[model samples]
Target: MAQEYGYRWGHSGLTADFDLDGDTPRLVRLARPGDHDLKGAVEAALPLVDVVLLGDGTGWSGPRFTGTALGPRLRHRAHHATYGDGWHHLTVELQDPASRLAVFVEYSSPDGVPVLRSRVRLRNDGAAPVTVRSVSSLLLGALPSPDVLDVHRARNDWLAECRWYAEDVRESVPDLGREFHGHDGRAGLRLAGRGSWPTDGHLAMGAFTDRTDGRCWAWQIESASSWLWEAGEADHHTYLSLGGPTADDHQWRHVLGPGEEFASEFAALALGDGFDGALAALTSYRRLIRRPHPDHEHLPVVFNDYMNTLMGDPTTRKLLPLIDAAAKAGAEYFCVDAGWYDDEGGEEDGSGAGGWWDSVGGWLPSARRFPGGLRAVLDRVRERGMVPGLWLEPEVVGVRSPVAAELPDAAFLRHEGGTRVTEQGRHQLDLTHPAARAHLDATVDRLVGELGVGYLKLDYNITTSAPGHLAHSRAWLAWLSSVLDRHPGLVLENCASGGLRMDGASLAVTQLQSTSDQQDPLRYPPIAAAAPTAVPPEQGAVWAYPQPDFTDAEIAFTLGSALLGRVHLSGHLDRMTLSQLGLVQEAVAVYKSLRGDLRTSVPFWPLGLPGWTDEWVALGLRAPVAGATYLTVWRRGGGVAELLLPVPHLAGLGDVRVEVLHPSTAAPGAGRAEWRGEGVRVRLGEAPAVLLVRITAGG
Candidate 1:
């Protein structure tokens, strides 16, 4: 709203005029409400189809539900409105003239954040059931710019995630060249994801920036299942269409009985001056939509013994000293990672038969690993003023575990032939079944009530590729909600082979997200620095694993990786010398001091989006409080000694004060910083070093 574009809405339809960084306003129209003038207006305005509902029928664009097809004729029924501080909500109902199908489109936008979100709900009103094949959550139509546009999207996998790229839209789809000449054929780029894991192949997000003007628009889908988004040029206009599962993508066909309704996942659209502006708006939107939790306000530091520490093999002797060291370093929650429940072997044994994945279920403490019982270790953690936590893969039953035979077949997910689906020596559990739900409930209750455990690191290591997996995810979330309702004090950490399952549906219920499982310190800066692009800064947990062998500068670099996000401490703390341990303590102290400001801050990249092997990566969290901004800068490999960081928000301010909040003394020859124009220039003496700088306005 700050950059006015002549946007307006009414009962008939909504229309907006894009500025395009010029005085003239280019008109763009949304779908009209009623059918009275729909045919005429749709032809004149070239409106993009917002909601695509597929059925066994034909339409103007060929097959009713296939690629870029217009399925049905919808007429607007009614409209409603609601407004609140920094937000507005609008809902419009549309009904098909021939069928009993009706679609309700809901749109909400916050004044503070430049984002517009939309979701669609399909209902059956006729006496017979309706087989609904597809529904889109969002669609936007815009007149094509005079110049070409570049499309941007991110690719995600297990270890290498959040990698982004941009290219000419025409290059990807050659048909776009024809659109420029007078050929109006349907042509554009389609990006989508299928099956249980929402972000397995391609992330459910996209963005486009005009080559002529700097204006940009980005969209993200918040769904736990299959989804798709298309950017196409047709009739001389470029449009963006996105939505949840479709029959073609996921074999998803739902039967809606009379009076039954189904709602699609939420999709959001953000408009800004450039990629950074769009990213900033998206960051604010994620915060606004997330469920409120007390843990967000507390911002406690968590120490997990998984990366570069115990490495998924924990025992009583190994944990006791590490627990005390973590407490001394100011860790509030001490999570004992995997291998805590292995009874087949003792520590130092590496037989594949005794691996953690093959012996998962039953959730019992290994007597061999904990000779004095797991409770003793947890009690020690509590005595040290830290909460006790455990690692759990609740969604899977090890193929070799006794629980696999104990639970009925109904408790496990099955394939088309009634055969149980197994992945990586594990069978997926169907939480919708009462037996499965009860088993998990008892496991959690016993751990919390008897062992005095206060936190759970819920991890998922398998992907459900068969049909009907969505039911299991929904049931899992429901079970989590019920547990939270019963025991509000228990905190949950969500992880999936380290961030494979990081999505809106799961993040809404869990307290924190483990950003990645990358182990090497040098290769982790990009993932840590770019985490805010997807997850909220306060909820993103980045590992700061400072070990004993690391140099002073290396320790600072590892610790600074988590300065802008939640500090997840790890590494061989018990092996560190007193001097090295003191440095770790100092970093924790600095993080605790800035935790409060992190909750209300918006993230910005002073240096453009970081590449995987960038020598220098910087992330800034600008707090709403005037003259306050927290910066985390990392110097990796070889680069220039001096770097200039732009602060657009504080550009006009005459003078500013900048100071290092961590690493009390810079490495020898690391030059001081000074305000230069609209940015700050700083010099660091060596690679593999870090600095946490705080910038404030000066009188």
Candidate 2:
């Protein structure tokens, strides 16, 4: 072990350090990497005192109890243990003897993977209950601040989502003057998620890059509800703090009775050489934390009749031909999207105008829509060698739905005044109630076990208020866990409007995530390119909507976008000519060949993170297999036709070969591509064109 400033670094790169000495242990470095070599500065810059003011006019922080005979101070020592697969568990225990309040700071790190997972647990041993107003999941004393640092964050909207931006940290928070005592003043930036949809306003992720050293640290809060992270400079060191559910943000307050304990959600931290390296580490860490599912390996292509295709109105007549076309295009799952459960109008007269949203909860097959019954359409899907699936918004009931009247008020989310909270013409269900759980359980059982449905596209369209949001999230997790446990083969697709609930907590339970609901093919490349930043490549379902009206180049561009991620096939394939359909078939074949690689691949950007309207954007997936990489390049209107893409990972490999593996119509040499020094030179003749290049070494 290497020791400095009372901090010790173990062989596994974990560093154990405290915020202040001679005080109850307030762990600031839990599993922090030892190679950083900034221990002295970090220790010296530790805050003299940390406190949270309570309603009783007492300051509570760092696991100590107030108004106690132990003089309001607690002391702790570090302990460690080893588990399976070189996993290390480090614990720091602090206790207020007089008040009998104990707090444990836990850190878990596995060998080889550069991730430090931290969570806090509080236990009350006193006879009286103790209330915790705030507790941080992680508190880091210092982060590298090499001359220039860039702070990165993701902005999300309804259709235009996962747009990332990087800004100079100093520009956002002007430097505190460097005086004789160095920078004593503090400046900070706080990013947070507010409600049920943890990713509604922004992603629960952040990164800081030290330009001088090319070093970066990235972190994400694995939470389904509210979360907050703050980066600040105090004294001469920078501190990063992360946590979930606070009284101020989520109206979260926990009372720990005698011998009772509460644990906070885990916060993951990673370190790397640059933004790419950090992202790679985070991606690997994400894989480690996700619940293993066979779908991750199978990576089936799904055809959902939404997006620019059916737009939610699907009848037997409208779906039969689409089903045939989808299977012909190599899709393995055919999902009849929304409007499958509507009962307000008959299929012949239904226009899906005002009744779709308000008539939700019945979940019964529409008699008029599926004249031969919904099972008939599903049977056709199975006969075409595809799995049958249906879209469901399970957590809500339309106010006008008959099921809403049948279920008790306790089954739905209600305000303090006993009135149910409704949004977007739907009433949210509170899964914590048994009746609600039973209803959803029966729905899944019927759809999967009885109907032979192999997949479910679960969607949530509205947000709930405060405590209800957190409660609903927990309930949803429980219900999903039960469903998945009962039917291990059933695949679940999570969506909220579109990409709103795309957080780690929900993603862990679902097999795939819809990247967005953006309809325009021209505006989808950026979203598809940036999705890996928020979700794993195999789980990000990008839509490939090819219609007869689109130019051949446009078809390739749209189809090529989904080649790099999970293909959410859509569009008017049933109405397309055989030639147009051939292009879709070619793209699907290419994706099938590459889908296996996607399971073990991590994303990299040759052009860096994409802008909403960038002329030329490129995304590369570097496979774990030696000398193998898949590159997707797009040249939009008005952009340069020729560009050089640097592939640092393939730099030392000998004699690289690149080939266009999609769109059989593109001539053998439609686009000029050659392996140059440390990169590939790609030249396209026209705008709005794309190339899915398979690159390998040993040519």
Candidate 3:
């Protein structure tokens, strides 16, 4: 397949080619196509090099692959976006610093498609970018029906469907929550089957546009999301910078230079089983490549379920004191949890469906509860100096909502077979449907623009629980990304029934997530321990202090949440012992000091293993500025008789001083050093923790 402007397309499963500007780069296959890997592509689409590959093809969603025509040295990673034009979208500019460029992909479903997903950037920063060379192919599997080939829009009873796509939105509010919000369209592309991939059976297309930019480039192939790579060892590796989209997926960015032109050749792999099957498949694909993108690192952010609390004068006043007490103790923001505005009002009043799809339009302050409206309460909290926030389940809606009765053809996902109640009171919001987005966009515009809300936490409490729903990973993740694009400054937390949605893709957008609903301090131990062990700490931001069990040990362990993400306070605030308060304050101070260093650096290990049995766990901070680490070894079953401290990264054994801090008893401990040319061996025992105190070279 050849399009004008040196873009030619080809796909034969395992390998494919894109003859862009005369140079042809082959895109090889990485693994066999599967449901999981393709789901991840729809979910995250993060850019990364294929340094690592999952051994068993079971976990990855599609047959993953990376393009190495440019090589890591040349840096050719990039993202693309097609407009409401369906599969084909245009790229806009976000940031173009020096040799690095940021492209914005935009789309809107004013037309008839169900879900719209697009990519967004390509950076060129080097001495000079050379001739751009790339190949586009998808890892695929045969899905042989023309009917199945054309994926349309459908809705379950829970909500209506809408046509929406990613874009470089140009909407602005004179005063965000008080003025207005909207999106600016860029370019769109129509869908035309270009070809099929080699290794796995899939389809493909090229990007050709007639916009003002006058840039028309031809590209090839859309295979199954699973078979992204095949054969050519170096060319097709799973790597690229991910700019937009949402959820736990990979997105990458690249810097091309003099002689290096920005080029992105992609293979589109299509699979259908809806979101759940997609997610299960995505889970595996994410497990394959562990590269870190820009958004993946942070200061351990978290979610506080306070935003949906008081939307009026009465409840706002009640929450003021609680908000003040919590914010001051090292908390970031407190999202008001459910029950604002006629939240639970009634079917006739938009209250009966208070959970997922309930809409509190007008920020309706329950006349019975707050009479003064939500604005007044927000003002009081601001006066007290804390960031105020709220929650909204944009995907679900209730049957009797005043707005529901007046909308256009709304899309919805209904209860599956074997179900008795067709009217579960609420319906899911079909973000993929055009009509649905118009309603949701307007709804959020009013709540956010009219109301002075700063943080918005969107929770999708049900994933696996519902079947036969429009529950694919791309649909929801796309919705989440669109929300973020609309409100870039707001912090969104992921709440899928108390951390049920803690995965790679969701973790991408929900910078912070609620680990569990059970705020009981007792339950925090086993659950919390597995988090740091199961996944990297960056995604697990914010573990709240589940009340009533606020003991000194709890405070120390509560700090454990720090290892996962941010520390959240969920206990009954009014009932705290003075000692408990003091202890929490101390832990916060200690956590604050270590956070900066923790967020940006990689986890270094002398033991190389984590969360296993040890006198303690040792970690090394590789950052030059904050170049030190803290190892915490809890007193184990035999009682930490000794600690085996290792300084494998240190240059010399003789120049460091190890400070011993004992727990329970101060019998004192010793620091012994051994000389090793490349590194050092430092040992300590009896001390709860041996703070590796390195002395200055001059001193």
Best candidate per lDDT, number?
2
lDDT of each: 0.76, 0.78, 0.37
In candidate 1, which residue ranges exceed 4 Å CA deviation? 1-72, 84-87, 143-147, 175-183, 347-353, 625-627, 666-671
Clashing pairs in 1: none
Flag the better candidate by lDDT, 1 or 3.
1
Q: Quote the lDDT for 24 in model 1.
A: 17
lDDT of 2 by residue, 128-171 (tens): 88777666787675565523678999998878888999988777
> Candidate 3 residues 1-699, lDDT tens each?
344222322222111112222112112112222312222221112222222211212112332233221212223233243333222343323333333433233321112212122232244444554222222222211112111121221110111111111111111101122113232111111232111111111112212112222211112221111112221111111222111111112122232454343323332221113322222222222222233333344352232544222222225446556666565565555666666655444232223324424343233445543456667666665666655677666665556565555544335443445331123455554455677667777766676677767666665533322322213234566666776677765566666455444433455445554555544333343334333322334544445453546444444444444442356554445456665655555555555555665554333344433333343444343334335544433332332344444544455544544332211122234334433444435554432323332222112
- Give residue 608's error in model 2 in angstroms: 0.8
A best-first ranking of the candidates according to their lDDT comes to 2, 1, 3
Off by more than 4 A, model 3: 1-314, 342-365, 414-425, 464-479, 503-505, 518-539, 546-549, 604-626, 632-699
Model 1 C-alpha lDDT per residue in residues 461-559, reported as the tens digit of each score: 778766667667778888998988877888898888776767777777888987888888888888888778778889998999999999877888899
What lDDT score goes with residue 80 in model 3? 40
